[model samples]
Target: MKFSQSIFLPIAAIALTLSSASFADNNQRRIDIDSKVVTEHKAKINNQRFSYTVATGTQPVWDDKGDAIATLQYTYYTRDKVDDRAKRPLLISFNGGPGSASVWMHLAYTGPRVLKIDDEGYPIQPYGVKDNPYSVLDIADIVYVNPVNTGYSRVVEDKDGKLLSKAEQKEQFFGVKADIKYLAEWLNTFVNRNERWRSPKFLIGESYGTTRVSGLAHELQNSQWMYINGVVLVSPTDIGIKRDGPIKAANRLPYFAATAWYHKALNANLQAKDLDELLPEVEQFTINELIPALAKGGFIADDEKRRIIKKMAQYAGLSETFVEQNNLDIPTQFFWKELLRDRGQMVGRLDSRYLGIDKRDAGESPDYWAELTSWLHSFTPAINHYLREELNYKTDIKYNLFGNVHPWDRSGNNTGENLRLAMAQNPYLKVMIQSGYYDGATNYFDAKYTLWQLDPSGKMQDRLSFKGYRSGHMMYLRHADLESSNTDLREFIKAALPKEGQAAKY
Candidate 1:
């Protein structure tokens, strides 16, 4: 799961309401009999005003296993300003975690408004958010959705609640495939209801949501009929969790080192200015250097082993002796715990921006990352205000945007297999990836490593490009960094569109 979600931006004003609870005289359906304003909120950023709406789900969405949930949504719309039907793209976006809502992305990127971030990396303490003049809403119609159980999107039930199934439940919708599949169906229904069927469509997902899009791209193609032209994956990680089988996993150590180096926590030096440049070196070293050394084991000649280990030590930014001590295999969790361990500090496994020291000599990891604290409760109001006051959707339940992973229900995957499926089906579809140097969870290395996994033609590979920034997973919280990402994303979007001679403009 992501450490936090992007913020949910609303288009205009804010108001929330709750109706009288009324059941359909059955356990399956619970409808509120009456409705009234429950709450309202708003934000103004960069001289623009954004609003949100909050409501409860009057009807139960499910009752399989988990808890009965409800739903809440944030919407943004631009009428005349949006590109005409010929050019407009209706982009639906969300974060992963199957448990997370759209807050992090909404607050950080894509939304018409953004929550200001403090130097330590979180929405400001006074709780102020504002309109984003840089918002892509000027070009496309966008909505940040929280799934059935994450954010305020929930399901309320009488028997066992609307939720069904649990972890490793790969066969149930509660997992990966089901959540996205349902979203697709619901979205299709929503579009048909709203008359947006003709608009071009796009999906922007981060982390697990990247995995979600990998499948959604295919689903939208084969069954959904919402043909998509572009997908922007921010730090993808849908391949089988273990990478290579368990035993050979040690061979991929350079990736962890590269991740550490990007965070500036590693001492090893390779001649590359940033992650984008260093990736090739790491990939090469992993093949020509580290892989060979690992194969030799203790039987390898001493000088050759020494040469590789020294390079490894420098590349990994760990003490040469320490590298030798561990036999060149530093586990991911250990690296996370050790990089700053000596200083009695630890960097977050989720978002590297959070740094903490062990409170005791026992070397315990911090209770939570700094950003996690901000995600705890700050986003509810943002969604609430956006829903009722602006786009004016009505409901009466909490939106469950984040929840436990129910694999049984997951639609497809973020694996190399699925990405290729999407690309192969839509040869012209373009992929753009953005990574954050400080994102240890879905490190940039993982995305770069996927090059070998994909079987696309050389031309397709050539068309793929990636960008890495100095910030963490939700990097946009950093204003200047956001401007840089925005500029590049906009340029890429223009080039990928159907236009033949359009200049890449932001």
Candidate 2:
């Protein structure tokens, strides 16, 4: 529900209309669930030129009876002529949306190809991809995965050539646990078939995919006996970490300050300070002063309550009266709408740097998301062009950009604990979190909180690290972040790998 604003938009009116012929092709021209289309390519990454083979294909997800129920589409990139690939690391990448396709990271971030967007992360007229010199391919092979109902991934027909009922499909692949379970099994098959069981493996996920990979970290280890070396969470979700009401409310202040600072809406003194200088002060106040004040609720004295409101208003770039009117708790939507109300504009939920105009300037929230539309304008066309024209994987089946994967069961979400448990079991496992300061959807402060709570015993603290960017949810979209983020990943991968004679013991 936290990520529903960006990933889980309503799709009741759009009919699925997925044809069975798309899957059961006899001509061998169209792609099927059990198909593999290999292509060769070259790219210059990190100033180093190299050729790599891209194996774009669909792998089946089998049921308990060993029957294929669904297929997941994936693109794997491995450097060419690597005689000792067993020592090379493989990075398995996923984008969040519970229902959104993997195209975001596939075309924008760590992929060898990047969308032709501007340096500041805006769409351009010519929608296509260019060589990503910052891609981490120089150090590690990468694979981008599209889960069920996303991208070209779809439900498979039964042995009788009939699609399974809608109810059955949801039961198998449309929930937190269900998603983790099937993907782990599918990964086991992928590792075995590729003969890379000895290769060091890593998992990287964004947004809701963070939840998916966090769960998968434990699921793959415990269920399939697949041990991974590292886990990277980009613009992470709560991963089932519990935050009480007052704590949640107090945690939002630093994000408000960051967004306000980006818009130049903060007070003159606060606005003059750099983001790095400003955030720590706000963060200190939020933890030491605000959280306790909020917990007192109506029991606090009037003078104390008034003092808290003034500071909240000052930090959030809102009027004292407005902060007081909201009972000292501001909803993110309301902040998005009210931030630029006088200018007749609204900030984006995912990336506040993008602005939107509402039908009326008096609304509580904007009419639609500004950042998502901007993202689609570029990503949709570039991915379509790159996959078909460059990669040469052709198919008539329409790619579901943001698939209809709702009625998504969010129960039993203990994935945060699962990651901790997984780390406790595997001493070699390490984690790195990347978050954007301007990402209102999954605020950077909450990401820090999630990491802090991930291992309460503090034993795994040394294995964990956090990195912050100045952009939003998809931080790599910005040209500056693209370079630095990949560099961080390169460093993380190298550090997480064990020394030649090192043991896997604490």
Candidate 3:
């Protein structure tokens, strides 16, 4: 689902020992239903097919006496052959937006395979296609969950035939706490039915999904809290950052600047040096130098801090005076223009994967996320086609890979550090953060910056690993980067999984 303006929105596959498989032909273009209410999806792609299901369950909205009111749908994907004895790693994946679906991650990064983008790295194909050997399905079973009201998932209505409206959905499902509670119950049942209770469970969330995982980790710990092996957070958000506070707006500045330097069309000295080093300095400069300049709240000291502003402006690849004019508090929009204006272009705010040459200064909130969208549109259909024809599944509704995520719950009021508190309570729950160096939406540096600010008091650095890739947020879209990320994920999974012989004994 799209988060900001047009910029946002943000899979797992089962394993197949075989390199290639045949599509189901006539049987392929379909979905399998466990019941009238629950439907499963299976796709065959790249001649190396995988499968998944969209199963539905209900969560009680009140005390035990009442009928269950919420219908929750989660997408489950696993290896073709799951070893009963092997405590296979299970990752419950979710996207951001609070209102987002699991499609982006499912189709792009964590799924068994990926859709190919064009050379400019936008989602277009000569209709070109490729295999994602780096797909994590080899090591872990991935579940891309579309929280109710997203993707094909939705709410449970009264037998009286009540349909859910946008307002009703928000009233029922938009909040994080209730969503996680329902998900925990739903997952518990799904696991029991599938007999996957022995698996080592993990959660991988991007952007706001990261927020969901954090809280759910604790909710699972305290409420339905079970044994969770680990969590992989991509581009996380701190409640403290999202909430109204002295830090919310402050934390975003560095992120904008960090992304600005990487948007080559913007940075005048794009060829200057390795951006990896320069970005952190920009982050540090924003926090250590520029933030205080803004916080000073006085004309005289503010003037003196021009030196700091000069540094920030310089590091951001923007004019020093621009920083002065905005008093080092430039909003994210300005960065897009200031960095690229010289080239008669404006970088994007969404994925930061595109460049838009804008001649006018003002317009509606511009979503330059086409860099990401264009890449997936061309190939997602092919992948979906393969899933049905080659893999064993059936469906009536057409699989919606990705689309407009509107009326989202951007008013994030999820406070109560229970998520972090639970994480601290369960020292066993580890986290791995994978970030794209160039992603502007949830900048990698911002991810780290917010993490440090949260101060996970448990000294859990070993449990939390952050890896940087050369591409944008969906690093897997790039063949080379996905391979490396796959290797890293495999290692991570290996560490979390039960050792070979320890299966039943554990």
Candidate 4:
């Protein structure tokens, strides 16, 4: 889970209601839910020079009574002097945390600007922004939206200049269903306002944002009557897939093997084989052998259990005794701690490549997330400076890297099935998943499993694709994957666009 900002709002004002007093001028209190600031800029992306206009602003989120209840902050980038605006592709991007800002993707992934991190993604000195050489801006117009209470986004006072009741806040914007519901409506208004109704539309989200976009796929089609061309899920969650008991236990092996291989902790023969070669063998064992053995549990024969234990130890780089003691269900934390215990360090949860030192090596999990702290160190200053200096969107509001969105309702998460239903209904719709091989939280193989479960009948298999990377959760942070992932995205967008005069039929 992401950390919350220390500042807490009153229960009645939990919607992150902005005070009208903040915008006061000449002692006249006012509010502007639909204000904006525009700036012109130029960048060379993919070796192509282009002038672009960035509109950084807030758009109103209206309530059922035709009143604005909240304002979502968004930054949109459009190539200037485009001859045919209707034909351009518009990519809507978001990052996860349920409470996270859209900063990750905005400054580190697909946007024209990226952090000044090292080639391998560690924070560098004099942290700042640089032109992204691999941005997809040449092929698509992009918008990064911050949900309520994230970045500069905030819920607003009601018609009477009073904060909404707690019930209204929860019912409006704080749960799985509610989050998707409002965001779909918000997109509808955004498209209408920007006259993007005729453009080829795509949604790209990472982590919990995967659930957001997945549910939005169905919600937009069913509720808002808006159809999208493609959906990209990066380092995706299960998206509400049911992976209980044996299935869950078996799924962790491939990730363990990948992380182990990266750290060179595997046995000599397994280490000798390339990761590409070793993973298939482990995956085959996981699906064909491990899942079944785990399903048998205590009922399994002694010899079969011992054999499974040995294979698991070899692949996982753990002692067979420990595997046996855990009864074949090894916790991921234990794996992270135990993997490099001899070296007096622990692996990161999000990216195993990053190492951390613990106070004592006696814990099941590391003292902290080695990757997240490093990310915040680099991302915080970069985004804060970029918004004010480059974009010229001035505001005194503190940008919450991770806002207060707890008591977040996780119920009714049927987004995976929802995406399936959306695909079934919209013949023009296609899906692509991007995963990092070293992402332990939402491992790569489980993403493939989500793909498999999404279309069990394999009817839309042709429209589905999966791409894996060598880095962790935010794979694009690495220089090589940055170039390759953007290329994959460009290809996917072009492939998903319907041919001229083509029918939306199977």
lDDT of 4 by residue, 223-306 (tens): 998888999999999899988899999899999999999999999999999888998999999999999999998999999999
TM-score (all chains, Cα) for each model: 0.76, 0.94, 0.78, 0.94
Sort all candidates by lDDT, best to worst: 4, 2, 1, 3
Clashes (backbone N, CA, C under 3 Å), per candidate, total 85, 0, 29, 0
Model 2 agreement with the true structure over 1-506: per-residue lDDT tens digits? 01011111112122121335544556543336666667677777888877888877777888898877788889898898888989999999988888989999888999888889999899998788888888899999998889998999988776676777878878888999999999999999888878788899999999999999999999999999999999999999999999869888888899999999999999899999999999999999999999999999889889999999999999999999899888888999999999899999999989999999999999788899999999999999998897776676777778888887888989999999999999999999999999999899999999999999999999889999999999999999999999999999999999999999899887
| Model 4 worst lDDT window (10 residues) | 1-10
Q: Where is model 1 more than 4 Å wrong at Cα? A: 1-76, 79-83, 156-172, 240-242, 245-280, 295-300, 361-367, 374-401, 404-415, 500-506
Off by over 4 Å in 3: 1-74, 80-86, 126-130, 164-168, 240-260, 263-271, 299-303, 359-368, 372-376, 379-416, 456-458, 497-506
Model 4 segments more than 4 A misplaced: 1-32
Clashes of 4: 0
Two-way TM-score contest, 1 vs 4, winner: 4
Candidate 2 lDDT at 478 equals 92
